[model samples]
Target chain A: MNRNRSVFLLSALVFGFAFLYVPIISMIVFSFNESKLVTVWGGFSVKWYGELFHNRRMLEAAWLSVRIAAVSATCAVIIGTMAGFALARFGHFRTRTLFSGMVTAPLVMPEVITGLSLLLLFVALAPLPFIPDTRGFSTITIAHITLTMSYVAVIVQSRLSSMDDSLEEAALDLGARPWKVFMVITLPIIAPAMISGWLLAFTLSLDDLVIASFTAGPSTNTLPMMIFSTVRRGITPEINALATIMVGIVTIFVITAGVLMARQERRRQLETRGAGR
Target chain B: MANPSYVTLGQRILAGLDKALTTVMASPPYRWSQGILRRAGVTGRTLVIAVPWVWLLIFFLIPFIIVFKISFAETRWLGSPPYAPIWEWVEGHALHVKITFANYLFLLSDSLYVQAFLSSLKVASVSTILCLLLGYPMAYGIARADPSWRNTLLLLVILPFWTSFLLRVYAWMGLLNNHGVINQFLMWTGIIDEPIVMLQTDFAMYIGIVYSYLPFMILPLYSNLEKHDPTLLEAAVDLGCRPFRAFLSITLPLSKPGIIAGSMLVFIPAVGEFVIPRLLGGTDSLMIGRVLWDEYFLNRNWPVASAVAIALLLLLVIPIVIFQRYQLQEASGEQQR
Candidate 1:
């Protein structure tokens, strides 16, 4: 009975893994298929990839998404890092809980609500001279920043909270101005958190469909929005190629990060042992 | 690091105000009891708190209020926001606002709306249950593994999510179609001679929900199971309780919080979900989210859309309130600990 149960569990594990991974494997394989039919495997070829490169709309949308993500992430990181530092470092404020909750509300709220609300706000504020009808790239970027900043703040704040408070005090005692001390000491320590937060924001902005769709002007269709509408038109080899490329890029980047983190951990352990010796 | 463009009209007005006056004389005076302000650099702290708060109020809170207002006001013939809000005139305080329960009445009267809401709840509940069933065992298996293997297992679980979620959905699209691998393999193996039509069905929607939400279930379960004492199970066995009974009595109760958190995470999102049902489920699925989408986009009934949104929000607020109280209680307990 015990042996049978073990076998059953092992099979279950294999099935689960297969179910999770097979579709991804199929996508990668079909990207190389010479024929257009997504399921029917043809001999492997790079023709689809070649075709992918020539698709002007796909390329333009990809470029536009990259620019939006980059700008939004940069803004989000700065604002988020600053907010995170305040919430985590500044303690015992009467409205601290309220502030924290407000920052996180966007994280939990439905995208529909977030998108609709932002759209309404933009319409209401459009008459202002400087605001310029928040509907194009700027509006999308602003919406992305609004959502992504909350995440950035949470990450950086946690990092700040975990650090020793005395590090800042030590800098202050050395006659460093508050801003100087922060730039020199505190910022460097939490730089990784900020970078990760930026990366997260970038990914989020790139992947956004709902909010981007709602806020996007006539000229500002994002990659996901394009893909969605394209898929709605009909599935094609081009869509398959795009999915394959995205999966490959994300998988490679994440694996590299994982490997780098592992190496850093090992090196840290070795250094500690060397010090002990 | 200060931008030269920081001198916006708004920023200039803010900067020109006396700092002490701003802190002490604001409508609700900034209470200094939070120890953070004294510790962190004051200028940075102020900018961080004040700017995001103001942005959230303008963009997030104001939009919801606008929607709420539109929900109550009578729409124009084109079904947009009314020109005038509540008003009074010389003619015996004439009220332009003719508030009607018509929208709410329309929603409640339609069996479709009620059915859709019920269907959404049913799907979310089933998906949550399915996630727990599969996820709990997997989490247990991982947590009970050698300590060195735990992180690797956890990473593997999270790895799929980093890829674009839409891509994952697309992958499922290919996998679950009639000519897809699962059906093809089953047919080839003589498990069934005929191809099953799985796409655009409730089964497909269920699979999509479970697939998307599996990680949420696993992470919480893993955390809770890792914290549970192995010795408790041994004690139960030593005290003559069967393994299943011991699991029910000890393991299940211990993991209640994880279960609650995971279920809420899955259920709440699933309730408002538009993408999965539209993509995977058939037209007859009758989920509230897809209905809202139809109202807003296809039907161009903005007033009705706002009403549906407000109705959903009202429904969701109850669970959110409960979750907040639960979190607060847990936080206080931790403080005591």
Candidate 2:
């Protein structure tokens, strides 16, 4: 019976992980295929990568996406951190219910509804005084920030609730002002969470296609938008090359985060043992 | 002391500022930092809270209102706004209001729109069920694994999520196309003489969504399962209860919230999935999201598109509320523990 259960579990893990990874692995493998046909096994070559570099449209879109992601992620982290703190610390404030609802409602709201609503808001505001009438960079960035900041807020909130509150309280007891205590004591502890929150926001903005498509102007295109246009025509080796590069960057970040977290856990365990002795 | 009882409010504030500045930074007269610190003191917390609040109100909540309003307006070709204004000022101190139920009536009366809503519900429900089935076992397995291996497994599950959503869908396109790797492999193995039709089928659509969203289902389940007390199962077995029986009575019931949370996480977004149905499903796909996309982009019917969006939001409200309540319960549950 024990053997059977273990086998069942092992098989489940195998099946699930394989289902998760096989398509991605195959995509990576095919990026180097020499032939135009994506399915067939051809002589391995990096020619498609060279072609990708020369594709000015793709390069420009990729550059635009990176810049938007960096700016939006930074802004999201700042705003999201504040929202997270408010939710954690001021749970019974005047507008707490509505504030928290607004923060979390975006997490599962359908993309289409969100996109339409945001575009409509922009249109309604366009004729008003002092607002930009265009819908390219600033509009898209604002849309991205709204879409992604909720995610950061949720991340930071969970981290804040899990942290020991006494550190901040101890600082307060020692005559530190509330804001000063948050800056000097609380911020350092939640810094790791903030970093992860920023990474998540960055990647989500980079990955978004639907919201950006709605908010973007006729002339500007993000990378995913560019991919959607081309891939609609047909799949090509160049897309595989692009996929490989994107996946490679994500993999590096994931591994680095994992290693650092593991090291921190180890050091904490060691300190606990020493204190016990 | 300069007449201890005669200090003015301004001088008192200055003294406090001087002391604070001298502690933090070796500075000249404290007048320079007062402008910054005084403002911070006045409205720092309120400013932080209000910024996100007003942002969400302006950018997130108000958009829904505009969409609702536009859904009642008329689509106009020659107007600055594509939709005709619902209210206008008429000649000689008269007020005019135009509200049409045409878009909503069309949406309800047309079989295409009705069928799209029904089909979207069906697809989302079935996908959520499928994700639950596949994800539960995987999450259970991860929870049962050695502690050293568990974190790595969880990380592996979430790594793909960090990659591009469009790229993940494109990966499916590579695999399910006629001459794609799976079909080619099957034919090579003599499983079929010809390449079986996989792309642009309902099967491909399910696979795409399930694969994309499986992590969502698993993560919540794993978090729930990881916190299970092993002693209960051990106690049940010591009393001669079968392991399967114990799981049915204990593990299953306790995981109900996890199951519900996981299902909502998958079901809500899956209902309005645009990319999966667009790239994977056939030409005849009737997802409300795709319909909305077509109505806005191809048909240029803004009013109808807005109507479709409103209907979708109505369908989602109950589930969104359920999800919100579940999150609150979970947070409170954690705090109590």
Question: Best by DockQ, which number?
Answer: 2
Question: Candidate 2 DockQ score?
Answer: 0.53
Q: TM-score of the candidate numbered 1? A: 0.84
Error of 2 at A135 (Å): 0.9
What TM-score would you give candidate 2 relative to the actual structure?
0.93
C-alpha lDDT score of every prediction, in listed order: 0.75, 0.88
- Give candidate 1's iRMS in Å, 1 decimal: 6.4
Question: Cα miss at B136, model 2 (Å)?
Answer: 0.4
Candidate 1, residues A39-85, lDDT tens digits: the string is 77778888888888998998999999999999999999987887777
Number of the predicted model whose lDDT against the real structure is largest: 2
Q: How do the residues A1-277 of candidate 2 rate in per-residue lDDT, one tens digit apiece?
A: 5567678888989999999999899999999999888888879999999999999999999999999999999999988888888877665788787888899999999998888889888999999999889888799889988988898888777777777588888888999877677765677667778889999999999988999988887899999999999988878999999999999999998999889778766766776676678
Task: Name the lDDT value of residue B295 in candidate 2.
Answer: 90
| lDDT score, candidate 1, position A181 | 70
Q: At residue A179, give the lDDT of candidate 2.
A: 68
